[model samples]
Target chain A: MELLGIANYLVLFLTIAGVYALLTLGLNVQWGYTGILNIGVAAFFAVGAYTSALLTAPATAQPPGPGLPVAVGMLAAMPVAGILALGIGLITLNLRSDYLAIASIGIAEIVRLFLKNEEWLTNGVRGMAGIPRPFAGVDIAGWSAGGALYLALTIAVIGVVFAALQILYRAPWGRALRAIRDREVAAEAMGKNVLWFRLQSFVLGSAVMGLAGAVHVHYAGFIGPEAIDPLFATFIVWVMLIAGGSGSNLGAIVGALAIWAVWSVTELLGQIPEEPITGFGALRVFLIGLLLQVILLLRPQGIVPEPRE
Target chain B: MVELAQLLIYGVVLGSIIALGAIGVSLTFGVLRFANFAHGDYMTVGAYLVLPFYAGLQLPVAAAVTLAIAGTALMAVLIDRLLFERMRNAGPLVLLVSSFGVGLMLRSAVQMAWGPRTLVYESGIQLPLLFGPLRIKPDHITIIIGAVLLVLAVHLLLTRTRMGKAMRAMSDSPELARVSGINTAQVILFTWVAGAALAATAGFFLALDTNLRADLGWHFLLPVFAAAILGGIGRPYGAIAGGYVIGIAQEFSTLVISATYKPAVAFAIMVAILILRPTGILRGN
Candidate 1:
C-alpha cells in the first residue's frame, strides 16, 4: 500500500484546522469577547451538521442524494443551529459563570444523546455517510482532490465570517458586548440591556458554529453523534482558545491551527520506535496531562494573552 | 409498599457513591473556588487504579483497595501542589478549563493504559447478606458503614481538629483566615487530601458493583454535581444528604423512563435546583 504524500497530509490537516478555526472563533466571541465561557460549542456544530445532513441526505421515495443543492442546504442549516443555541442561552445563560459552564456541558451532552438515540432523525451511531462534496466534477485523479476543494471552501467561508466578525467587533454593538462582558452590572447601569447583548452573542456564535459544522460535514462526507461528543467540543475548543489568545479573532484562528499541530505531533510521537515502553499510548495521554499541568502552572495567561487594545 | 422499599434501598446504595463523590467535588470547588470538571475523572482513575493492583497483580481485594485509595489521594495532592497551587490568582475560568484539560489527560491516559475495556475485580470474599424483604450485598453494607464513619471522622476533624478548623475557616473567609495567622496553604492541602481520599474510596465501591471503565466517572459526574448542588455548595453534610436524594431519584426515575435515561435525571434535578433555588436546600454559597 502506498503512503500518503506530504502534500496530501498537509491538505487534510489544513482543512481540519480551518473548520476548527471557525468553531474556535465562534467560541472566542462567546467566551473571550463576551465572557460566557460556553463549554458546549460542539453541540451547535453538531446541530448544523445533522440538520443539513438530514435535509440533504437521500431518503426513501426521494432522489439518492442530500436532496437540496449544497448551497441551499448550507443556508438552511445555519439558522436552525442558531435557534438551538438561542434556546440553550435563554434557559442557562442567566446563571453565574460556573453554572453556565456546567449547563453548557449538560446541554452539549443532551444534544449528543438526542442525536445518538434519535435513530430516525440522525441514523443513530452508524452515522450518515456518502455526503456530497462540493464541486465534485473538478476532482483530481485518485488523490481525493475533494480535500483540497473543501480546504478552499473552508478558507472562503472562514474569510467571510472573519471579515464579518471584524466589522461587528468595531461596531457600537460589539462595544456594548465588550462592556457587558467586563462588568454586566455596570453595563446595565449604563442603560445597556446586558441580557440582550449576551443573547445576541449566543445567537451569533451559534450561527458561526453552525456554519463551521456545515463545512465540516460536507468536507468529511460523514457525520455522527460521536463526532459532536462533549469531549472533543469542550476540550479542543478550550485548548484552542487558551493557546490562541482568546478575545482576538486572529488569536482564535492561530490557536486552532497551533493546537492541531501540537495534537498531531503528539499522536505521531506516540508512534515512535520505543520497544516495551509499557503503556506508551497511555504515556502520551500522561504527556498531555503533564503538558496541561505545566501550561496551567506556568502560563495561565496563555501563549498570547487577549490583547488589552 | 414493596416498590417504595426497593427504591429507598437502591437509592441509599446509589446515594452512598453520590454523597462521597459530591463531597470530593464540592470541597474542591468550595476551597478552590472554581468548578473542577475533572473531579469525575478521579473517580474513574480510582476505579482503574484498583483493577491493576487487585486483578492484574492478584493482590488481596482489601490490600488492593487500600493501595487504590492511597494512590488516588497522592495523585490528587500531587496535582494540587504541582498544578493548582501555581494558578492561585488566575480567573476561575482558567481553573475550570485546566480541570477539564487534566480530566481529558487522565481519562485518555486510562484508556490508553487499559485499552478502553471494562474489567471487573473478582471478589474472593462475598457475603451476600439477606434482610427481610430486601436483598443486600455485603459490599453495600460495608459501603454504608464506611460512609457513615468517614462522615463522622470528617465532622470531628472539622470541629475538633485545628487543621479542620483552619480548612473551614479558610473556606468561609480566606482573607480573614490569612489575617488571623492561619496557614491557608496547609489547610488547602488537607482539603484536597481528605476530599480526594473520599472520592477514591467512593470510586472503589463503584468499581465493585459495575465493571471499571474509562468513562465511569464521566457517567457519574453529573449526578455527583447534582447532589452537591442540591445539598448546596460548600456544605459537606448537605452534599451527603443531597447525594442519597439524587441517587434515589435517579434509580426510581428509571421505573417510569428508559433505564438509559437515568443519568439525565441527576442533571434535571441539578438544573431545577439551580434555576429554582440556586442557594440550594442547605443554603451554602
Candidate 2:
C-alpha cells in the first residue's frame, strides 16, 4: 500500500515536470534559438490556463464561463496567447533585448491586473474553478489511475512538441534565426527579414507557453491568478533552460525534471518546523535563486551544454 | 478644482520618489549596460535597513537614513565585486538574468528575516499641512527637497568631477575609455555606490510616503523602469523628467480609471513611448 502511494506521488511529480518542460521548450524557442528576452512567461501561462478553465468551467460556477467542452477551451488557449504576443511583439521586438525584458515584465503585470480586476471576464480574484481533467468521465476507480492517464497525455504532448521543435530548429528557418541572433546586421545584409522572423518566433513560442498553461490547469483541475506566479512561471523556466543547456531541446526536458526535483525537495525540507526561522515559506525560492547564481558562475551552459552543430 | 490641485500635489510627491529611484536605475544602466532588475529590491533593502537604526536603536531620522543608504551602497558594491564584476563580458542577457536572480535572493532573504509583515517607521500619522486647496505631509515635503538637492549634487558631480567624466566616457564608448587610461573598475564601483545610495534613499522616502512591506519596492519596479526608459536609456536627466511624467500621469488617471489599475497607466505610457519616441524625451544614449 505504501509502495502504491509512492507510485502515485511519482506520477504527480512527472506530470508537473512535464508541464514545466513545455514552458522550457517555449522559452528555448525564444531565448535559446531566437535570442529574444521574453520575461513575461506568466502572462501567457495565465492566459492559456484561465482561458481553458473559464471555458470548461461547470455551469454552477459564478459569473459563468462558456460551459464549453474542455477540448474547445484547450484549443482556443494557444491562439489567444499568440494574438497577445503578436500585439506586444510588433512594438517590442525592435527593442534592445534588455528593454524587451522590462516591457515583457510590464505586460505580465498588466495581465495580472486584468485578471484581478475584470470580474465579468475572469471572475475577478475568486478565479475560475471547476476545470475538468482531460478525461473526467473515465472510470479509473481512483485518483491514482486518473492521474496516471493524464500523465500519459502530458508525456504524449511533450513527445509531439519535442519532435516538432527538433525539426523546426534544424531547418533553414532555424539557421536564419541563429544568424540574426549572432549578428543582426549580418542577417539583414543576407536579406533575411529580421523583425518578421523575430515576430514569428515570439508568437510561436508564446503559443507553446499557452499550451503549457492549459496542460497545467487541466492537471491541477483549477485555475487562478496565484497559480501562475511570475517567480514560478517565468524565472524558473529561465533557470531550467540555462541549467539544462539553452539551445538544446533534450536539455529543456532534462533541466525541467532536474530543477523541479530540487524545488520539490526544498519545499519538503522547508516544511519542517524550526524554532528561530519562521520563514520556511521562503526556503525554496531562496535556494533556487542561489542555484541560479551558482550556475552562472560555474556551469552557465548547464549540466548538458548545447550540442555543437 | 481642489481635487485636481490635490492630485497634482500628490503627483509631484510620488514623482519625487520615482525620480530618485529612476536616477539610480538610469545611471547604473548607462555605466554597466544592463538593467539591474534587483534595483527595486535595493530600495526595499534600504527601507528595511533603516529599521535597525531608527526604530530599534532610536536614532534620529536623518542619521538612520544616512546609515541605511550607506549600508545599501556597500551591499551594492559588494554584490558587484562578488558577482557582476566577474560577468563583465557575459553580454547583456546573462547580466540581466543574473541581476534578476540577485533580486529574488534579496526579496526572499527579506521575507526570511522579517517574516513578511507590513512595517511602519512611525505609529501615527501627522496631520497634513494645507496649502489652500492642497494638503501635503511633512514626509512628502522632505522627499521633494531631498530629491531636488540630490539631483543637483549629481549634476554637479557629473559635470565637474573627473570620475564623472570617466564614467560618462565608458558609457559612451568602452574601448575609447579603456584606451584613455580610465580606471574602469573604479568607475564601476562608483556607479554602484551612487546608484545604490540613491535607490536606498528613494526607497526610504517611498516607505515614509506609503506603508512598508517586503514587496514594496518590487511592486513599484515597473514605474521606476518606465521613468528611466521614458527619459531615455543611459540618461539620468531624462529619467528625472520621465519620473515626473509617469508619476503625474498615474495620479491623474485615478480620476478616470479604477484605483486598482494605477500601475497599468505607467505601462501604457511606457508602451506609447517605446512605439513613438524610443530615444526618450531628452534624447538619451
TM-score of chain B of each: 0.94, 0.98
**Per-residue lDDT tens digits of candidate 1, residues A1-309?**
236687778888999899899999888888877888787888889888877776776544111354776787778778998898787677667777777778777777778788888777677788888677686556576666766777888899999999999889889988888898877888999999777888899889888888888888888778987765557565777778777777789888988998889878877776676754566656665665566667667665567776675
Candidate 1 local Cα displacement, residue A179, angstroms: 3.1
Give residue A274's error in model 1 in angstroms. Answer: 10
Clash list (residue pairs), candidate 2:
none
Clashes of each: 2, 0
Report every candidate's CA lDDT: 0.80, 0.88
* lDDT (Cα, 0-100) at B271 in candidate 2: 93
In the range B183-269, model 2's lDDT, one tens digit per residue, is 988998999999999999999999999878888898888999999999998899999999999999999999999989999999899
The CAPRI class of candidate 1 is: medium
